[model samples]
Target: MKEKYLSTRRTYRESVRPHDGEVRFQVAVEQTDLLIVAQEDLRHEIASFVFQVRGEIKNWILFHPEFAESLSPVIVDDGAPEIIRAMAQAAALCDVGPMAAVAGAVAQAVGDFFSPRTPNILVENGGDTYLHSTRERVVALLAEPDSGAVVGLGIEAEAFPVAVCASSATIGHSLSLGAGDLVAVRAQDARLADAAATALCNMLRSEADIASVLERAQILAEFGVEGVFAQYNKKIAAWGNVELVALN
Candidate 1:
């Protein structure tokens, strides 16, 4: 799955966010749309940084068009932009295309860019998120748009500076070879979480694939994947540090 929150990005953003009093805002540049929560309103700073980083990525893609179009991992030079290198590394680790990690990588980049200015920050691109905070936050899970969100992951404050990303074959614009409802992955690296979510979602062709997909998530634990939540039809599976909770 590539993009899960395109049509309902705003609604989804509002639902998942904690009511902490932090300033919330949005910035959009072409295909990159971000919902950000920070201790202070840094819309202007974030927008300029996002524009610069996107331009760097675009320029590199122009020189190497295959990097953007490949369905498999591609190597990047030592001098590649930080985002490009992160995507390439994530794709290699998850055995998928670099684009699979684009959303999360961008979110992470933006979050890191302003980390020094704010003690708390959350950057969400589509359904991929990068979070850092001094307090716990709950992120709602929306396996199916029609059902809204019945559950959420309760992340402790200690898990700050983490990434949570989702992918769905049945939900959005992202291409998925599987038939799963949703797959969410958590990790220290947003790029890895994003790519891993996509890779794992591709393994779920039916409800029967849920168990094996969860097993696959366990194997990924060694690679810094903190947790995973998967759903296919009536079956659902979770592994690692995933903390499921009811969402009102």
Candidate 2:
């Protein structure tokens, strides 16, 4: 299995922090490195939740090794834990493996765990995020290396508790069959966003594939997908309510 590394760029988070009065912190454990933003510094609560969720996932994977290693969706029993079930659902939706949704699933679980206590919460696992904010938030896109582009999406405040997940073929250790530099998806939940991003990236083999990918992505809008953004060879394409903006 490929080891997961920290894929999220902190510069974007730092640039947008002033708009929201949320405190930011980091929690690292094994393969998981989470960048969390909340109303207050809740390191203890964050640590407890991360460990418990990670443990449950690790234990389930141990019992069902196929779930962790499969590149295709596997049937999960109803008796599985909520997180496990969520992973299965996301994988099935995108026709990918359950592990593809791991980061987003974990982020969503943590966000849900603290939603009642915090009015605004943002949890980023790798490049996948679970965001719930009272005000609009702009999440920057860190797509190519050494590129002079400052692209991002201006998510409306009404779109709170949405997931913005990214997948890349030129970056990170995740498995992808496409050549897209970055593919981001917005959904009602992080798990679906993460899985869909991976599935979309896998279809984008070249610049010519952008249109078809966008069409497929638009079909997901009915499934709570707010938008889709993809960049390849300096060419960018987007569909749905994606508020693209350039930062100074």
Candidate 3:
């Protein structure tokens, strides 16, 4: 797995800004760029949580460098922090490294911190997201080069608190062996979504690989993945309960 450096970008946060009465804010700390939305201004609280989670994860990484460096799944101790355990388990399920789930795990942590105080919350770390909304939410798909094209997701309000994480080989700093434009995964937790996205993208090198990859993605259902959406060479495909919508 490649661990390339990524800078904070506003394009994705701006593209997915919710119009459903939710307030949005951006927070950048280190390599984690977050787009947090809620019923009210909770930027301070969200930032605090993000910092705490990042601190814990950083400490864990310091103790276990292998967890951060391994490209393959690793077995972590039961005493690991909740975020670390979540990442480890998600990585194991997707057969990727724990770091692959870092963004989603962090997003989920922030979401969990505010889910009790508010019924509607969205925490996006990098491109991974943990969202809970009182109204239907539309998540835009902004893959590389095809930025102007209209492709997105129509997520129901009832499916609030779900994780929608994406990975790409053609873009972003994440390590992927394949050459897919994008791989999006929806699951009960952001960790699984993130890791699965990376794993799936690493498997898709061409449009012809879609069928087999989609077949393999079916097994992810057992790991709490609800659906998958992929774009490769301008071709799009979806599986499970994902509802594709056009933004333009």
- Best TM-score goes to which candidate? 1
The TM-score values for the models, in the order shown, are: 0.94, 0.92, 0.93
Ordered by lDDT, highest first, the candidates read 1, 2, 3
10 residues in a row with least lDDT, candidate 2:
1-10
User: What are the per-residue Cα lDDT tens digits for candidate 3 across 1-248?
Assistant: 32332543446565656566778888777777788887788877777777888899899889889999999998988998988998999999999999999999988888887888877888877678888778888877767533543777789988878888988876667778887888899887899999999999889888998886788789988878999998887688999979998886
**Regions of candidate 2 where Cα sits further than 4 Å from its true position:** 1-20, 147-149
Worst 10 residues of 3 by lDDT: 1-10
Kindly state the number of residue pairs that clash in model 1. Answer: 1
> What overall lDDT, based on C-alpha atoms, would model 3 receive against the true structure?
0.82
Q: List model 1 lDDT by residue over 1-248, tens digit each.
A: 33344464445665745455688888998888898889888998999999998998899999999888998999999999889999999999888999899999889999887998897999988888899888888878888676578898889998789898999887868877787889999898999999999999999988888888888888888888999999977788899889999987
What are the lDDT figures for the candidates, one per model?
Answer: 0.86, 0.84, 0.82
Q: Note the residue pairs that clash in candidate 2.
A: none
The model with the greatest lDDT is 1
Residues 57-115, model 2: lDDT tens digits? 99999999999999899999999999999999988878899999999999999998898
lDDT score for residue 149 of model 3 = 31
Residue 144 of model 2, lDDT score: 51
Task: Give me candidate 3's TM-score against the actual structure.
Answer: 0.93
